[model samples]
Target: MDFRIKWLVSVLLIFGGILFCTAQERSKPLVKHVVLIGSDGFGAYAFKKAKAPNLRKMMENGAYTLEARSVLPSSSAVNWASMIMGSGPELHGYTEWGSKTPELPSKVIGDGNIYPTIFSLIHQQLPNTKKGASYSWGGIGYLFEKNMVDIDFNGKTDEETMQKAIEFILTEKPSLTFIHFDQPDGAGHNIGHDTPEYYKEVEKIDALVGKILSALEENNLMENTVILFSSDHGGVGKGHGGKTLLEVEIPWIIYGKNINSKGKLESSVVTYDTAVTIAHLLGLKIPDFWRGKPILEAIKYEEK
Candidate 1:
């Protein structure tokens, strides 16, 4: 071959090699889902006492934070809103189940109407990023409009919701998936937090966790994604209503993404911190109004 032709070909090959490497480096990993599993009315005491193998496995392989308190009143409506908005009750105003405006029958409580959710923030920040979403009973879908997430499924049966969460982990593989289990808390309300029914619900929830973990492992997502298991609020005798330990303190666990080996949060992390942690995970710039810090220490290490 002529010297000039050989030189040109060599240069093009080298340049092409560089581009290939760069593309590989920039390629987003398969580990995209951020599973936020909420165990309603599950308190620290319940976590410690509960004989849940799946939850125990998560604790052993994830970061632990104690004294994680929900907001004042500790009601689901207030706390879940705080979690999704990355703000306190002030921004997402719905502290009470129903604000008595003189007259009007009691209506269903909703978080989206009162608060702007993380889904909206995610859409605004990362327009191309699609999020996997499903909430059984939290009624958080209204905040995340259809345009915000490519896959939006809510208000499904408990079995259906749990299965959908697993399906998203397998097929959709969203960058963020918020899964809410309206059990234990629901059971506790109908029965009692410490009752047999509540415990049964816990067991069922643990099984669901196992299913999710199995899906992650089968789909090879355990190394990159962050699996967080938390509770909106804890219930006591029969329900959660006030700022008692049963109402405020709940389980906070972060698994995968090397989160298992991180240090704990010294200061008490509020419910709003969940949103902050999620935003931080996705490299989003949190707004100034956000009163919580990202739990950066709790990320599982995986090769990018």
Candidate 2:
């Protein structure tokens, strides 16, 4: 072939190759990344009346349960561990604030609860896809299992924790992320569970939620992610670790493309079901030890 014709043929081949690569990249299924958010002291009553436009949008766009309940005494350590381990007060051990357990020696925060965190499980199973990413969950200064887990930001303020969360999801894009906001809870204990602080802090946290959502949107990871919003426990008469509604009652919202938007919650659900739910959504089997049902009701789409 002449030089001119050969050059033209090479150019067409390169263009075709580019188009083919683009098609393949676009065709790949979006990976399922779990982002669990905890709004401290955000109860059903507070959630219902809270003037949070972002939370309202999440409730409408996804799913919301009026009867969500936290762990016993509604303490952060118990509930967070329960949700991650997919166990109850019996299995996960640490069932109260400032864990009385003689082990771990660390403060009874996010890490004191004894159980397999969702992060540890997925990191072990999905190592190839996970890329060993660094993350900053909502709770700050708490130590959980360091086995393939990062809890750099634990028990921090609403804005601070959310900033860390957004940064982690945007920068690391972790396969699993859990965020806890100790706002209303920390504020609630000082001045009654249902005081002005609860309302004000919840609204503040809601703004952070919107900001995080915006980050996800900008990164184009909204559709590819599974979001879980819950609480450690509610506060009654100042602090939690009680069975009362003010302490145990919570609000649950799960949204994202992998979930079923219209699913209805049912039948005595608790924190134990959360970890299994995340595992189930990620196309992974619940471990034999995970004595919790996958909240099939909250899931909008049936896993195939």
Candidate 3:
């Protein structure tokens, strides 16, 4: 009888230890890498008719919203700046669509005399973390502090840009990677939003997204990686920078490890929220000056 009791106690202790270890692992941050993909002029409305199976799969498996809003004026540079800087143009001060520098002085300038951005925050907190940015737009290069980035590549086309981003991810295994595609915006400007040609451009971008996903999977980075997809702004007619719903509303999608498979997000998401979300995933300190809040509902682990 004493032998049986001892055996039972041993089994209980082993089981208890396993449970404790599992809980501890769950409480720790699960995301080790983050890939942020931004598509210029890819509006939320495009999903209404655009047959983007790959993006649709991400939306179904991850937390997403078609109602995420852009900052006022709904332009490229201002909204892109807001997305990474965690504040509006009032704080980050890139008010114009073609703004190469802050039209108004930034509310808080960090190490490089540039407004505090996600890249800056990550660099300050995780000094050894590899960071990379690949974009087809030349204007995007000027928004953040280049000195903090390890690899900054500007490709002549969206295809080339994403290809370079894949190469960087495979070779460098960067902790954070931001990719910007300039198509669909160029198509929207040259053609017209809501037109058939614009939809085609969005479809092409979707194919590019598929390629990126494949690369991540091939390199076995998907297990520890989280991907967030968003846009600078939507468009209406042949141009943007307006107050129309078609121009202000954008799509936001988050997928991968530690993300709740909440089909669609109900919470209100803004451009600045992207930065805060990335910071939260990487376990970095979100600056008090930033106006954005992390999308906690999409995360599986309870942040303490």
Candidate 4:
């Protein structure tokens, strides 16, 4: 009887220890890497007609919202800056579609004498971690802190840009990677948004997304990598920079590594929230000046 009681107590203690360790592991940050893919002007409305199986699969497996909104004016530079900076044009001061620099002085400046961005946050918090950005648009190069990034490649075409980004991801295995494809916005401007041509361009961008996913999977990085897909803005009839829903509504999708498959997020998501979400996933402290909050509904871990 004494031996059996001792054995039962030992088993209970061991089982309790295992449960505690499992809980601790889950409580800690689960994401080791983050990849943000932005399409220049892919509209939320286009998803209804666009046949993008890869993106659709991500939507089914992750938390997404087609009703996510862009900041005012809904232009490329303004919204992209907002997305990565965790603030809107009013704070970051990139008021124009082609702003090469802050038109107005930024509210808060970080290491590069520019507005604080996710790159700035990562560089400050995770000093040794690698960061990379690849984009077809040259204007995007002016928005973030280039000095902090390991690779900032600006390609002349969307395909070249995505390829370079993939190469960087595979070679460097960066902790954070941001890729921007310019074809959809270009097609939206030239061919017109909601048109078959624009949808085709968006489909091509989806294929590029598939390539990135495949690269991550082939390199055994997908399981621990978190991917967030979004757009700078939508468009209306060959031109954007408007207040219409058709021009302001963008799709936001978050998948992989501790993300819950809530499927179709009901909470309102804005462009600036993207940065906060990335910071949250990487377990970095949020800047005091950042107005956006993390979309906690998409994450599986409970906040302590």
Instruction: Give the candidate number with the greatest lDDT.
Output: 3
TM-score of candidate 1 to 2 decimals: 0.79
lDDT of each: 0.70, 0.67, 0.92, 0.90
Tens digit of per-residue lDDT, candidate 4, span 28-56: 45598999999999999998899998998
Q: Estimate each model's TM-score.
A: 0.79, 0.78, 0.90, 0.89
Deviation of model 4 at 99, angstroms: 0.7
Q: Write the per-residue lDDT of candidate 2 for residues 1-304, one digit (tens) a residue.
A: 6999999999999999997556323122334677888776677778656798887777777776757777675776667767777776666576566553523332322332435666666765676544222222333223245545653554334566677667777777777777777677767888776677678888887887788889898889987887788877776667667777767777787888756556445546677778877777776645666677767666655356
Estimate, for each residue in 91-166, the C-alpha lDDT of model 3 and write its tens digit. Answer: 9999999999999999999997899999998798878879979999999999988999998999999999999999
lDDT of 2: 0.67
Model 3 ranges with Cα > 4 A deviation: 1-28, 302-304
What is the TM-score of candidate 4? 0.89
Candidate 1: lDDT of 2? 100
Segments in model 4 whose C-alpha atoms lie over 4 Å from true places: 1-28, 302-304
Ranking by lDDT: 3, 4, 1, 2
